[model samples]
Target chain A: MSKDAFSNHPITPEELPQVNSQSFTPLSNTYIKVNLMCRLVFWLMVVSALLIIYWQPWITLHKLLELYLPQVQLAAGGFGLLSSVYGILADKNKGYAIREHDFSYRSGVIFQSVVSQPILRIQHVELKHGPIDRHFGLASLEIFSAGGAMHTFAIPGLPEEKAREIRSYVLTHSDIAAND
Target chain B: MTSYQNQWLKLSPVAIVYFAVQFIKTIGNNLFYLLPAIFVGYNQFSENALIIISGLGALLVFVAISALLKFYFYQYRLSEGRVQIHSGVFQKTHIDLPFERIQNVRFEQPIFYRPTNHVCMLLDTAGSNKLEAKIIALPKNIAESLKQEILAYKTENTHEANDQEPQTNEEQLLNSRSMRDLVIHGLASNRIWIVLGALAPFFNSLSEKFVKGIESFGVDVDALMASSQYAFWQYVLFFFSIAFVVIALMALISILGSVITFYDFKLTRSDDRYIRRNGLFTRHEVVMKLSRLQMIALQQNWLDRALQRVNLKFEQLNANLERQSAGTSGGKIIVPSVTLEEAHNLATETWPNNQLSSINYNPVSKRLAIRNTLIAFWLFVPLAAVLTYFEKTELATASIAAFILSTAFIILSWKRRGYAIDDNFIYLRKGLIGVSYRCFPIHKVQQTTFSQSWFMRRFQLCSVKFVLASGGQTLPFINARIGEELIDSCLYQVEALKKSWM
Candidate 1:
């Protein structure tokens, strides 16, 4: 093996080029409301299920609930409150950028990350709307590449029409570079 | 053009049988809990033969009807550089897959269809979780013709657009394994565990059959066991013989499995595609495009190192999940039991103009060894102390020995952890008992992550994970700065490269 293959340059994170996500257009602000609503619905279901089980006549666990219900409620309430705050913050932090050559997305509240995939490398784009999303007139645009199982980037809570438009644009670009 | 427009067709009549068999297999796979019930019912056939037969006949008839319906509904049409499939009786699904998006076209002829010259055609599209189309049983000629048409369309579209011209037209015979090598591979493969696990549930039945056979031969096994228990040496001898028999059986089973799977393995390259053909009974022929290859892994276990042999695996994009779960080689080509020189030759042939020797690897920080040792110590020391407190000296001794052995293994693994990066490719080599050296083209890297935990941040260490199109590779316990640099350089290279990944 040639010794020159190894470089003596010192490694540092500062040497890496910083990616500015501010250049990207921010997602719809209503996304935060939608996210909060989803979280609230999830917690509501859990709380209701607990209440239903606790209130069941067949159950002989009155004493057990007296001992555990307060503790469980405190823990669940604390977790729900913490997650609600995190969810709103995360939703605010999430944004996507589409350039002439590539697409980029910035995500994560604490450990921030910006990932970019070249438009030419994209394999397909999907526009999905769940029942809740449909009611809210919101959709998620999922971009996939020849890469592994996970989607390259999924920008959720876009206006349904906007998501469809982005999907069509991605489809066209991906088709042009399909042979790759 | 008129004939092509009229090419929409359903599968052959025999496809019903194939579909029925497939249905049964899928049910048997998913409904594993029902297997014991079925077995019990089968065993009581003499008592309830009429009822069991009638019930089984009804189930078979139901399966046949469903299969017939599925075969009837499934229709495929090929025209205008696109393959369209229409299937499903209730919620119909229509798929229009362009030739350019089709990553692979696999043709399979089951042994049952050999006489009828029928083949199963599977069309895999890029980025899709499931296959674009599966034509269960079509005439062999039609399937082959469709495959050629799709391939020709894809090549014509991409051939003229490629910046880099074709290297050569000459076909090269890369490597072929002999019968002797196959046997060696069988002996080397650690597949005995799979056989043993699969047969565990049937062990009782098998032992019962053995006992019955011996009794029929007038050998009193119960009396022998009772008598053997009275003498210490005899009991020791009996257990030793049993262990010997189990080991022999396991080895035989592993060897046979390997031979069946890897018989007559051959690899050949023509232009930009590598073709691998193997298998003793159901021959599998897989063709992979060189451009689509995501990673190449060279593996050598302790036994392999002792035998001076290695296994080379080539991973490609979008492997079928079902096939992989079935323990079949899916979108990966394994060249087993080749000498080191042969492996090098194959690697060079696959990536010509690249110096396989010039890449330099840098080992991870020595702190990794310390970290590993600390982890082993924390995990085992408490267990050993508890055992000692309980006066379980034998268990405590075993735990202490395990702690030592594991610590040594981690240190060895730490010594082996190294990564090398070049302008074109990134190489990662690690492992203790079995070393795996992976080489991935820089352009094929889809994502790069440099993550640090609180402990790692305190120690100025981090782990870098590279998610390639085929799979993921990680370099753990490296200097945080180095991880960042590596991720940045890889991303830069990936962005700058104009070449296609897949």
Candidate 2:
């Protein structure tokens, strides 16, 4: 296989293109809230577990150390900070790669992975948003592939109009197959 | 007992009673494990016992909490066009499954559940490959009532089977689609599958007993060898004798199982639908639209081919849906045990008016069959050797070798003998045990590709692959030109088909 097969978009479009304005309906904010709420719950679990394990409840003199936390607490804080730094650094390097045949994307820190789906394999497309995303006109694009109900591709932080245009690109195109 | 009325007035008090009995049995089984712990924890006899008692207490507490949470949180309702189920003790799942998405619904009420009128429902959903989501338990009456509600929504009042006739045009649309063949097909299946099933447990028990019996004779090999010497060829003879018996028993068990399960196997064709219903203990009904079939397959092992029996399988276009929650409909293969002529007739039925296969078949070259035979012989040599070694007997080894050689010879012969296709269907006869002939409408193909390995490429041979909506099935290794022509014809046919088959 050629290296080009694996490479992200080597060519950058100069000056960001305007969003496609036709047939766009932003996703309901409820979807976004539900997704974010799930993410928040996961975060809370990790946070609470760390607090219970590391916090010395009986040590009043260690209150100064409370600012620093016990051993496990420090490790968790270190982890959070490490992830935040990596997230922003990775986000800076991240750029959308679009192709006539397929698309590629990567995100997250330790769990970072790249996903690519052929247009022919996509079964459906959906634009999703939450209340916070609605205010910013930001939406997430999800493309279903094959028989799977979940998204094959999820492009986050895109304007609602862009998501709709992507949906049309998938829908109106003959090369792509649609779910019945 | 609270009275519940069925819209269909078809109530099997048996379904609900079976479910209740099973539920009670499960509670009883759990109690056997839980009673001692409960007594110890409640009595709190000693200091050392307190820890163990507390552990048991904790388990019981957790169970109670989970059950409480479940009762409080779980809710399911059937609406006009969909069934909405919301369930979670802590993390909730709101499932909105439309009635149209339901593919197959299985009602299972275990033997133990015979006392109470309760039945568990397993719904196969389209595109979602998960085990069935549970619909709430209701009286047999209510269950039947719910089924009628959905039927009423989907069917028009015209061809009413159940009491609630369709009032709207949408239900009429569903009614127009016939289902009379479904019941008919279920009745024709073979009864041999049940007989086979009954023998399975018997063989398993026999094997276990034999193992124990052998162990009871003691572990020292010297004594066994000495005793064996008094007998004929000793270890070799004894081992082969036992191995042969075991293999025969296992094979018999499997054959019987297949016979019993498919004892009443039936397939009925009505208009554009092929309905197959077969099962013994648990009957199954599957209805497939003719147009949705991706391929009609005919297979015959050496034994079947020689006997002039062919097993026909029609593969439908579907997904690897999760076992429980699958589209009510999926790609299915109808397996009918029939004579070779019947299979040919069924293949024609697969494509009612089709004449020739899309690809022209050139007989497999003599060299090709020789090549295939050599590959088979090579693969089987090591396997035969290993089995002999495991059996540790000369007679067994000889018998196995003879079987292997004969199988390879059959493969060698079958490959040389092939058929040609003209324009619409593909007929393939390959392997000794894996004989297969596949037929599909050339026009229904969505995409086609020809692939070649280096050796094949050098030989001007390539494999043509046709990808339909279901999945890709390939006819490998043919002339590159022929492969290309077949691909082009398929593509052209697909293009000419203006209907939205997507």
Candidate 3:
């Protein structure tokens, strides 16, 4: 009932123990969009956005005037630039991240968050391609976490072969019957 | 209509006739309607000539007839591996749903459905949304036999723990309910909803009468406020009079609605799941796995708080959908009349490992109090100004001031509600009299985010939102430090090697 109850007995948030002990089974070789395919796809979304503005000037011009867009061209350019700068700076945040122990990914700007999961949780992995990705022989790898925000993660564009490889690795290690 | 192969399976012919008579009186209320139609057809609005008169009569007759037949043609049988339900009038349907796929089966033999040895049964799971897939009226004996076979099958095939697609769903339906539970829930939980239903007619009349003079269209709340001062206290007294009459008129309607909704509520447990069934003439059954339940929500309002009652709602997973689930909800709730202590016991019993905490002790930020007070003033400014200028009444101004002051007090109280986050749990409380609460295990958190706007940053405040598995808990903006701390706890949960279902 008093304010002191908080500071007097605060709950501590500590780092999880990570050692090879107990009945823990080490998850197999599946980088959560860590492979080259994801990085490539991520680049492709940015490139496509840029390309559309260059190719379809009228729509862009209309959008620019109506103030319908969230951020201005300058702001978009800034966020895009910031994201790229962050990507380059992402290695510091790399660790283990997974949806359902199926596929794990780790990347961060100032702070690193790594998630890992077992193969059973990897309901499905999808490789999506846009016109630009198709032309560039690149694809984006999206890993479905099955539940919550972990349901899907995007690695913009990767080489087709690498995407297929990651998907295969996840499927082999995981035991999710395809609903289809 | 699908021919009831066993035509003798019809619900009591006598009871059916009796209910039909009630139905006819309720729907055929316009028997003299025909006499008026011929007389008034060319005398009034031609645009709605049919719709306002003959069309409505025909529609009511059609609905009443359909209600009668839907009651009449309803029949079922239990075969070797599945059950059959034959219903509908012009268009016919004969379903042969296998026993293995039937998630959980429940039967309701209401006083009426019972007399004919007939019962309404619901066969549900996460698979389909067909209307009949959830609610099907079947012969009581056939329904019992079907349930027995399914239970026997579930017992025989208990091999895999994660048998995602089992040939048979193992959950059971609430078969027994005491009359006391119904009466308690009816009296305790549903008064406000009933009140709103009762006030509908009065609201329509009051809104049109007060507002029509001003905007003459769309609910111009401004006009209504302006009109309120016309008779001063006298006009306001008339409004209360209107409300009183509306309350009386709505009381019966509200009671009937409650009776229909919670007619035969029964809660049953099978294996590791809880199932609930309720509804009078139109029975409904919902089955949920114990582990699949995501979060339990405790809601109290001014009325409930005074009565020491809390409405319990459960947020379930997609896998736990009933045949006729509410409002695109992936959540299932048991809204019973319970005290704070009882609610806590029920919540803990349902989730033993759940790390739940009460509202943490803290003084709210002065800035939060100030901002809310200012916001409340902003909201009522137009009303305040209008009354001050046109009505030139001191009571009006005092009333507005009192409203603003009371709102400020609530804001101050809400700030005191505070928030607390332990390593594996987060708890929040809000509101005045009712004091709602929500708790969750961090590991079950989907994602958590910390966001701040320019204004929030200026106030040195930010919000940390935890997206839990249930879609139930909503994170409130607290002091910035606590928000960050909550996020850290969730992060810790995600990274923990030994994960407990949060």
Candidate 4:
């Protein structure tokens, strides 16, 4: 095939549907509360572990606290505040968009990423919810493409009905593509 | 053969040897446990040679019995458009593979079975990373007929008639390798390092014995080492001589291995597929359908570049990405030691529209070097400072030198990184010393991802990743707008083409 005979009409960059241009739907509001609750549980476990260590016979609990309480408080306080801020920012920035021919998920605060999988390329779709997610009436959608052991994109913090709808839609579209 | 199509059949009794080899392989798999036992036995029973001999004899007998049992239990049946295999001694299994699901059928002729005119048939399925089935010791004519029957069934069942043309018996030779070419490939490749790594654990004892052997030659190695009578130049020359000998030996071993593996290597085309026949001791035949090709990789190391050679690999749509990248995928075909012109010709032949030599490559963003050098600065500065504070001037100098070298490497690698896009294909080239070119059709991309760090966002640069059935390839530090356009274009092509990437 010669270059001239191949008749190439290049698509204008502006005309192409850009992944970064799509308006993503934000995750449910309860997802943030669930995140806080999970963080609280983790902190509670850490405090319990510290208490167990403090309960030892090396020194009196009050005396040990007197020696290291301020330092520990400072470290934990700084970490907790930063983590809460980062979590809120992440929740604000993370979202998903389903286009006619493909779907994309945007995530991260500092290291942002947008993963797009064509409907024709998807192998399967799955819906999952953990105990906390179930308590909050939230679910996650996992999309897998061929050749990969892990899911291509796992969108979290979606309402159960929305997640189910997306899963069904992907399954139908993928089935059509497979049949074709 | 057709009369017994639906009935169970037994393999030749010569399969017992194959099974016994498999038993020995299982023992090799347990070498970690056995190595320690052997060491302890050597220490404890070194005086009792009879005990060790009897132990080995008993092991051989056990292996023979197990092989016999396994051979006795094995059976297979070829039903309508499918093959059923039943095997195993302690844990029996029955496998039924449809013609459409079997991705490839390969036949291997081990030297041991050559006298008996038997071959081992391997079935590669779409659901597994490794060969799914191995029917050993099949008579040559029966194996050939079985292969034809399976191919015929596959052609009938496959949906894409445009690509699944009926298989032709005619074989047209496409390429063959000479012994000189194989020798160059052996020297240019890095398989010797893998061999050395596997032998490293035994090197300590081996070196000690080597020194003792030298002593038996009446050379006072210890006295020569302890005495400072030799000049520094003499020591350097001695070290160089030893290094030279070791490298020469390793090169010879690597060349021998290459010859054994690819002695009479040949690539032939039959209909719309390619067949590669190679190996001296264990002849191997691999068939690859053209439509299943996902990517073509051409690699050149420093030595290969100097020798004007390129190593070509045709990567197919594999079931597992991890195994594919590990070079263990069942569907990959490697044609080693082709010239640069031949490589380009083959690439153009495979993908007619994508002329690799004509495609203009665009280098990646310069920020890659800046970001990495900045990272190195943050990492090595503190180490150098700490070393200087500890009064280790020499170590500090070395760290500074390392930082400079790393920064240079980063810049050089950044210069090497480039990507080009044609009408229907995407090509990526990257390396520090020896470049590798990867090309695949745009429609074969299964997924696309564009990522941005805070620094990259500030610079309006992002990295793009494309996931194909073979594996994922990344274009790092490209313009964010270009990255977005590439992803969008890949997704669009994949949706519009509707071509089966399998």
Candidate 5:
């Protein structure tokens, strides 16, 4: 076997490029508004359903509703409000960094995580946007690796053009087999 | 290409039995959904034996015809170092697997094929976890030659062909398990618990039936218990004896299963490939290439630890996230009941620089124990309090006991969780009652993740996870600085080594 010259040499930690040294670029603020709007629509629909159920007479659930309907509504409203607040805080903390040979995404409000995927290992990259996201000019970039159905991580709420640029950059830098 | 290369090949006539078996397995797998229907129609069918008999006969006939049709439609061809298969009666599907993409070529000899001297060949590919192609009921000679042809093709197409010449292909016996060793491994492994778990839902009914059977034999168990013939201490002794007998019986069953599954187990190495051969009724042979191996896991449960033995598993690029049948998992070869020294020796033999025994493992932060205990208290204390308020003293006591046991387990596991790293390899040790030591080359990591909860961030501690082709391994609650340093070093090694993780 042909031995490489640097095979036996160990690279010290000081010589490596530290991930924490780089600053992360925050996501688009419009995603927070979109998330709030989605949450509002969902709670409104839930309230309407509850009202319809209460007005209906065919179902015998009226007896149970008469005792617990108010409490259930209050709980639902409280949960909705709490989740929206958490979502906004989480969105504010979400950020990503485009390193030379890898991409890093940092997220979570209470449980913070910084995930880095090597460009050489990425199988493919996808850009997706829901109706609400499109209306607010935002897109999400989904990165996939081999051996699993779920994406490695999806960096959400990027400007549409920035998402496209990142996708193309990943495609160009990664191996050709990634396109397949 | 060989002379048979471009011509369509049909399976032997005996493959009809194989297809019938496959059909039955498929039906059995989906039978859960049909259970309610069967119950609903039970009375109607039970009153008329003729209808039931006719229905079963028709079903058998249908199964026979479908198996025959499936065997007739299945055809495969070999051309230009690739295999193409055409199968399915109604769907008419096609599969193409190139020689290079094939990961392992395995052979199985079912009991039914013994009389005919035929073996079943399964081709495992890297593109998917499922078998790429299966040619059932092939003559032994033909299967051997086919395997040789594929291996030769793979060797020729490999990038490092010059170094991997035929002259260096010398087979060496690495390890073999005797009958005693196999029995010990069976006893030590946790498969007994798995078996009991599968039968747990029926335990109450099973015990009731046992009591009734004794009563039918004219043994008045309840009357004897009510009589003063047995003292309290004697009753306790009787209970202990029965428990011992049950445990012994279960252990015996587990041993029989282990012996049948891993009888005459042998591991052999030839150049860069490791071959494992085992099993009793259905002899199995699996081949693993060294280049594709991702990690090695040395697992020692409580019993295995007491016996000073460990079960070593060589993991590969297994896209199968779920457990599968023994032979077809494709990406792992398990060496059961090896000594601690032997396990380390084998690991070093594979990776050369993996000094597993000499490495110092740095334990994770103690804050892990506190956090886990807090989470457990948050989950269990409220339930225990409610039970106490409802005057369910027994249940409340049980809840508190469970909480204590879980808290102790968390603390013990936190003390054991550690990571050791060197220039070439990274090792992780973890478990509560048992321990699993996993190690891999630093360059094999495909991704690195650093996570910290609000509580952990307050203490400047974080968790780091290394994602590999096999799976992900996490080192929870470590210093934030060390986590960053580890990630930076791993990323550097991955980028600098320029090695293919596949």
Candidate 6:
């Protein structure tokens, strides 16, 4: 333990050590398009499922649909539009930076946060591509460390090739013995 | 060695009975929904003994056949430092578990298996996958020998000879809890609420039974109720007696549960591993390597503080998953009801050179007290108003009493919130009702976040959360400068440490 580092009182924020987020490059804007496509597919599936249930002969809900259909439609449309806009805006704030010793990710619009993980501490890296992502030729890279579930973070909307390259690079560079 | 030569081997014959019992239990659980139908049919067909007998016989035969088939198909082989299992009727599955990846191997011998000299062996693996390979009803000698072999292989591969202390030569008795200590632990554990919660579903029936029993005792309950003045006293006496009985029962249950779970508790250190052995009926032995330890928590409730005792709990990797699946209460190694001094000693022993007593704790902002009190007041005032509206003066009085108690509780909790960080470790102490002192190695912190809301910004306060392999620890309403400093230092340490976390 370093005794000299101990202080009776807290230092001012100006005097505190800083981790500069400005050094990290912003994420590619293509992620917003990918997110929109995925959301569209999700909403389409949800609407179709509702329509199928409504059209079913066994369901007597059709009688009440006349009273609620317009309201439900309006609500669904509004939600879809709001989510799309939020997705585009949120994408602008999402960014990740890879450094020699560690990687840092900056996220959130309302309550911004920056999280950094040392490269040696990374347990594993996963490349995930959903149906929509595959169609858009985009992939999300998930990085997991030996800590809590919350320690894991994902960077979405990377080109599939870029995602694969990053995954391979992380796997090769991270401390292999630490994972065991 | 001869057993190892065998390509594949079946479990002991005793496994047939084990499989049959397991099959029956599974069927019973899955067929719970059909219980009503079965009961109704049995009532209607009571006169037809032949039909019932035939049906039961068919089911018995089916169970026997399936158990036999399962036993026949299940085979395990040990080869090339790996244990391989093959099973399944239609879709055959093969699982290969390497000895190097095995985190822990456990052996259990139930009373039924005693005569047969068979034991169940379970191999646990680390990571989120939580894979457990079980070999049911193997010969006790074979299981023991296999466990030794696997452990020997793991030790040899995981640690170098120069870096590792010889196991048997360095074995030391760390601590043991006595029966008296366990009793205090049970009383002070705060598990009475859990016991009461479990019994909540039967509260109505139990109360009804009590009233009926009282009625049978020839008490004029209706006459008592008819007189308003006398009824008040009688009701108070009745409720007091009920509360007394419930508390007594809960105390007895908690004490018994603690005694049973922690009987003859012992923690021993050998080489770089800590071995815990305890339990009354079913003795359990859990071994964890020091390298795999994620956090150590020292806990003391209000009652424990009065008793001058604290519990030291060591959490290893995947401890949460183990607790969830095994349903083992207090799954971590808990040196139950040790004196505060002894708890500190144990913690220092586990993490050498880190004197817990010397670290200075920095308290959170005092403004937390006002915030919490206001929140509690807002939450309770409306309920009190509603009770007053309903003209339940007695209940309203009780609610106000509760309100005052909760306010005091919040203030006490606020007073207890503080955190300290040294070069090697960070210590966080916080909780309500019970105070917990959590210490995590600074280098092991996977992630750190410092966030400040607009309101917090005005006060120069922020909440810092540190993510460890085991879980996350948060220090709320702390000086923003301190939070930022801790985060930066933790990140620096994470990058600097050359040693592996696991």
Which stretches in model 3 have alpha-carbon errors above 4 Å?
A: A1-13, A17-123, A130-133, A136-166, A173-180, B1-112, B127-135, B148-156, B160-239, B318-331, B353-426, B431-433, B441-443, B446-464, B476-502
Q: Model 2, stretches more than 4 Å misplaced?
A: A1-170, A173-180, B1-75, B88-91, B103-121, B131-241, B269-272, B306-308, B321-333, B354-361, B364-423, B500-502
Which sequence of candidate numbers ranks them by TM-score, best first? 4, 5, 6, 1, 3, 2
Measured with C-alpha atoms, the lDDT of residue B364 in candidate 5 is: 92
Clashing residue pairs in candidate 6 are: A147-B469
Q: Ranking by DockQ, best first?
A: 4, 5, 6, 1, 3, 2
Give the least accurate 10-residue stretch of model 4 chain B, judged by summed lDDT: B320-329
- Number of backbone collisions per candidate: 0, 59, 22, 0, 0, 1
Give the per-residue lDDT of model 4 (tens digit) for B1-502.
3777899999999999999998898888988678878777786787888988899999999999999999999999888878889999989888888876788888888889899889999888775554387888799988888887777676665555566654568988888999998899889888788878999999999989989999999998999988999998999999999979988899999888878778898988877778888888888888888888999999998888999999999998656444442222457888888998888888887788885777778999999999899999988878999999999999999999989999999998998899999779999999988889999999999888899999999999999999888778999999988888888888877886567786
Candidate 1: residue pairs that collide: none
Alpha carbon lDDT at B223, candidate 6:
74
lDDT of 1 by residue, B1-502 (tens): 2365548877788888888888998988877988778677776777888987898899899998899898889898877888788988788999888888787776665677878888777777765556467778878877766766676676777566665443454657889889888777877777766777888999999999989999999999899887744788878887899979997888887778778877777788877788777776665666788888988889988878889889898888755644662114558888998998898888888886444445778999888898888988998999999999999999999999999999989889988888987667888999898898889888777766555565776888877778778867878888877776776676655654446787
Worst 10 residues of 2 chain A by lDDT: A14-23
lDDT tens digits, residues A98-157, model 3?
343334454444332233343443445788977756766667677654354433555544
Q: Candidate 4, what DockQ?
A: 0.63
> Which of the two candidates, 4 or 6, achieves a greater DockQ against the reference?
4
Candidate 2 chain B lowest-lDDT run of ten:
B169-178
Q: What is the interface RMSD of each candidate, in Å?
A: 4.0, 12.9, 7.7, 1.7, 2.2, 3.1
- In terms of lDDT, the poorest run of 10 residues in model 6 chain B is B322-331
Q: After superposition, how far is residue B344 of candidate 2 from its true place, in Å?
A: 3.8
TM-score per model (chain B): 0.87, 0.60, 0.62, 0.93, 0.91, 0.84
Question: Candidate 2, residues B1-502: lDDT per residue as tens digits?
Answer: 1133212122233433333344556778989998868666765556568677797688666665555555556666655566777776679887877776665444443333335655555556556466346654545556555554553443433345656522322211111101222222222222334544666868887767766787778765546666744666666778899878765565555444554444455667644556554544443445565666766767665555555555666665455433322112234645644665566666665666654224454665354554565666666666677767788567557756776676667555656445455455555445544466666665555444445555665677666555555555666567766665665455434443323342
How good is the docking of model 5, as DockQ? 0.58
Candidate number with greatest TM-score: 4
- Maximum-DockQ candidate: 4
Off by over 4 Å in 4: A1-11, A57-81, A174-180, B158-166, B195-209, B216-218, B226-232, B320-329
